[model samples]
Target: MEENDVLVTVEGLSKKFCKDLKTSLWYGIKDLISNIQGNKNERLLRPKEFWAVKDISFELRRGECLGLIGHNGAGKSTLLKILNGLLMPDAGKVTIKGRVGALIELGAGFNPILSGRENIYNNGAVLGFTKQEINSKLEDIIDFAEIREFIDMPVQNYSSGMKVRLGFAVAAQMEPDVLIIDEVLAVGDLGFIMKCFKTIDNLLDNTAIIYVSHNMPTVSRLCDKIILMEKGQSLFQGNQVGKAIDMYYGSFVENESNIVFTNGSIELLTIDLLSSLKMNDNIHEIKWKDDLLLYFKFKLNLYIDIPIFRVLLYDKEQRPLAIFEPNYDENLLKNNNGFLEFTIKHEGIQLSKGIYSINVTAFKRNSNEPILRINNVLSFQIIHDEDHFQPFLLSSTFSTK
Candidate 1:
């Protein structure tokens, strides 16, 4: 990419905030005075102050999308604010070449008392659009937002979904050189969100986008590059979008199982993943089509006639993917001195390349009541040469005429 092709450039950007309101105001006054005296040191942190965003740098060119992803309070929002010029950085600089459209927060640039139509024009004007330009796009915005009936109502009366629809429609329809979108699209309906994504796809060749989202699937679908943030710092930044997403999910893994519901009748003793490649003490690595073997040991407090066992698999986002249940007649649970041991074997697993977790449930024969239900008993990563967003990677043959 050439130098002029880079529409947005951020270098060594940093911002800090004081935890205490009174102290923040006092420090603000002191900093203003020090700046007047030409003796201010923005790099040093004062008492009760911490960096909300620190030393973050990236360049965005036309026809590319950059994704910012992290947990709440990880400074993703703070970085967007800085990029949209809503907050001033204590250090570093940002350079942009053309008009910028942003929808960082719900109802951010709109007046509550104003109607939706008025706010649309107001936002367009802020983006340097004249009356004729706004007029040409007015019907398109209303149609895209699907709020033709509610366009004349005050913005305060709009629901969260309505506000998001209108906000995104205006920001995306403006066709600005650079677009900054936060997580506001999460509030819109699925159909509307799909429409917004299509619009983004259409705009990608002419616009540079900075997108912040918690939905990994959408981020994976749209972003060409990814930045993972943690505690006001960049944990990972590069074109490896899949790896960055994996790292984001890895940060949330729990060390121990979460018992959802358990009766006094059974106690889980030990659960282990029978894999040759162990990523850590807890996570195992398996090939794409290899068999998945799990061993379990349980202590029965109160004996039942027949016990049923169920094993479920979940993706990185905790969505249930597959389930395994053994035939009651084939595999009988034998108890020796109130202790039972069994193994569940899944032949020819077809999971794609990603992290997965195991969930277990036990119940009495022909009963809906559960003796034990636990989540995240064991976690594993499937290894493959290529990454896929789908849960399963089935073998198929392709032909063309």
Candidate 2:
């Protein structure tokens, strides 16, 4: 990876923002006045100003994919905007070597009143493609978007999913030197997303990619390097993508407070972890081969028929790792006036040697409303005997409850 192969570079990048919209607008006006009055040293920020991203630096080389993972409002989007030239950095510089294609937001660079067909040509033109060049790839774009029937319809009339399909298709087909994709691509169906990934994989030979997402598995699959963002800055960036993703999830889980939901009839009281694989009855740590049992206790204030218990497994970072549920007796909800205890048992645990957490909830099957939801109710550490350098894979199955 020589410096000449570099497609993107950032130096001392910083962006600041105001929580108040009025304050931001006023600041903008003040800066404009100061610029007009020949004052380059305008106030960096007035009251309530904070850096969205501060002193971030990174580089992307040809044929490399950099993943950005962070929680909402963590400045991932803000940094992407700066890279895509949608927003300017308050300080520092970004250098790009080639044409940039981005799927940053829904209908981001499209005109609402223009038809999809027209927008295709418009985007191509913006990329300096002649009418003939656009016309040649036009069918492939429409075919990939799967919107040929509605290609002539105005973009404003398209559904959100349809717009996503078109946006990703155009950006992928352009095959620019640098491609930026945000989470909006997830708005498409699974099949479409798979197709998009295939296209991205094909582009990996030459195009540099900056992928922003909360999906760790996808990051593991696509990124050559990973960046964990916090408060608009790069908290961590390294080739250890898996560990970086774990940290990203950890940041989210650590900030969450344990509070029981009480609006519904049934409320969860406590959750316990038990195992039969070892002599210890109640334990917070488990071996890789252990049989684990989840003990759930909840109380009912009103009758709720056919309540469904949903259990979500998360890695140390609180990112959703898996979900397991067992069948329960329907008769238990008949009275719904007394406390209930249930056990969910599992065997053949296949997971990496690290800390994992659980989030369990109960709700009526008929409605999506939750009777009770708990986030990171309890955490357990998994001890394994495998070599630490080996790849981590967790495979487990639930036994009959």
Candidate 3:
């Protein structure tokens, strides 16, 4: 796009926030005093102050869609509010051309006691729409919102989904030159989401859009470019949506907690879950398709003639994801009087890049009854890899010494 076609330009944008309320009030009072005294010095943060948004820059041209993605409190909302002129930046400049339609927060400009129809007028006036213009689009807005039945009803009685639908419909139908949307669409019903996407698809020809959503799939589908934010800074920005998503999901793998149960029929001794770039070298993490290992020790309470071993895998929601039977057919446990050892080695562990529960269980030969079941006794994660095998061996001796 040409320079003249650039609709939004942000340069060195920064915003600061106090971490404590008392300190913030004090700073405000002190700053007010300083202003009265004409101090005219540089503004600096005092104790317990922090930057909510550091230096960040980006641009959007006509007919372009830019996506802002990050975890909560990553300064995306602050940036959007600044772009829409609702808030001022502490430093740097934001130049946005043409009329802007912002559906920032769900029911942000709306009154609870006001009817939906009345809210439509109030919001339109707030967004700089004339009475005749709002009247022209009134039927289309109501039709698009699918809230005709609730048009005269007070919005305080509306459900969250209903509010989202009405708010989106008004913001979309007003025909602004630039559209800025936060994560409010996440609360919309599926049908309304489809309708809104269709409307947005139609608007892309003439409007510039800034979208912020944690829904990666949708962002990948809609945005021409994506910017990743971390700790209030612009960490990455590019056109490779898949690569960006990989980094996004990979950042979350190491922070999961492991849950183990020792009171079951089988008592787990120790579990070893590691990933590496090569064999026998233990690294805390590795890229996709790196060497992996899963090893553990457990004891059998009672003596069994022949026992079969199994491992059950589950997701964070406690739903079963996959199961592995390692020493089921082979008679690897000739001596079952003491502790048993298990080892699973693979060139690259295959998983969808998330934490999963690794459960170990056992059963007697020629019987459906499980001799032991260890539920969620082990867990592991795949940063980005997938494929392996099953390996489990029974140990012969048991002694703490």
Candidate 4:
């Protein structure tokens, strides 16, 4: 791409923060004096100072979207703030070719005491829009936000969702050259979020965007380039969005088993993934079409007839995606020498490529009461060539004329 095509450019961008307020003030005074004396050293870290963002660089061309993803406090927000001109980088520079619109934080650009209507005009003027332009887009913004009735109300009274909706509507409707969005969109309801995404899709053709989010599906849907960050450093940056997403998912520490409810009659001795290959003691790796087998051993304190066992699969977000319940068979539930041992086998697993966790529940046959309910008993990953947003990857035939 030509240089002129690039709408946003960042080079060696770095920012640091001091952990102690008193120390920070002292350092600030010293730095000011050093700069006045023409001997400032911005790169050196003082005591209690840490780099929040360090040496991160990327270029955004018009019509391209970059996904900035990481765990909380990974400096994604700090990078966005620098790009949006909310904060200046101590060691690098950022250049933008056009007007920038940002919704980095909920109610960030709004005056809390001002009505939404007045704030809209203020934000528009900040973006260099004339009164005529703001008037032309006012109705569209109010309608898109779905807050027409509350447009005249003070912004401080708006709920988080309301603020997100209004903030996004104003930012998106103005259609600035560079748009920066943070995870504030996660606060909106599902319906409004869909609407906001549709607006983003429409805006992509004429704008360059920097989107920071933890929702992998949305990132996969929108971003053409991905950057994986950890500890304020970019661990991976490339067009291999799927691989970047995998790394992000890999960084998550498996949740420890949380027993929601349990009876004294049953004790879970061990649960293991019966696999030839293992990622670690806690995680197993398998191909997409491979059979998944889970072995369970439970000590039976009291002999209960026909105990029912259930296995639930959950995505990385902890949303339950699938459930497995074996057919009723008295022989399968029988106690073997004071212990219950069995294997739950899933033939040709159809789940899409991603990390998943297992949840197990045991109950008395035909009873609603659970003998044991446990979460995050086991975790696993399915390797696949392609990433999918849906939970299942079913086999289907395709044809074209």
**lDDT scores for all predictions?**
0.85, 0.77, 0.72, 0.84
- Sort the predicted structures by lDDT, highest score first: 1, 4, 2, 3
Q: Which wins on lDDT, candidate 2 or candidate 4?
A: 4
Best-to-worst TM-score order: 4, 1, 2, 3
lDDT for residue 204 in candidate 2, whole number 0-100: 84
- Which ranges of candidate 3 are over 4 A from the true structure? 1-4, 29-42, 255-257, 260-263, 267-298, 302-401
Model 2 agreement with the true structure over 185-277: per-residue lDDT tens digits: 678899998998898899887888999987777787899888888887788988888678756654544524365684667767767777734
Query: How many Å off is the CA of 126 in candidate 3?
Result: 2.3
- Give a tens-digit lDDT track for model 3, residues 150-247: 99999999998988888777777657778997877788778888988898889887889898998776776778877888878987887765556556
Model 4 regions lying over 4 Å from their true place: 1-4, 33-42, 106-115, 154-157, 275-281, 326-332
Q: Which residue segments of model 2 deviate by more than 4 Å?
A: 1-4, 33-45, 106-114, 254-270, 274-283, 293-348, 353-377, 383-401
- Model 1, CA-based lDDT: 0.85
Query: By how many angstroms RMSD does model 1 differ from the true structure?
Result: 2.6
TM-score of each: 0.90, 0.74, 0.71, 0.90
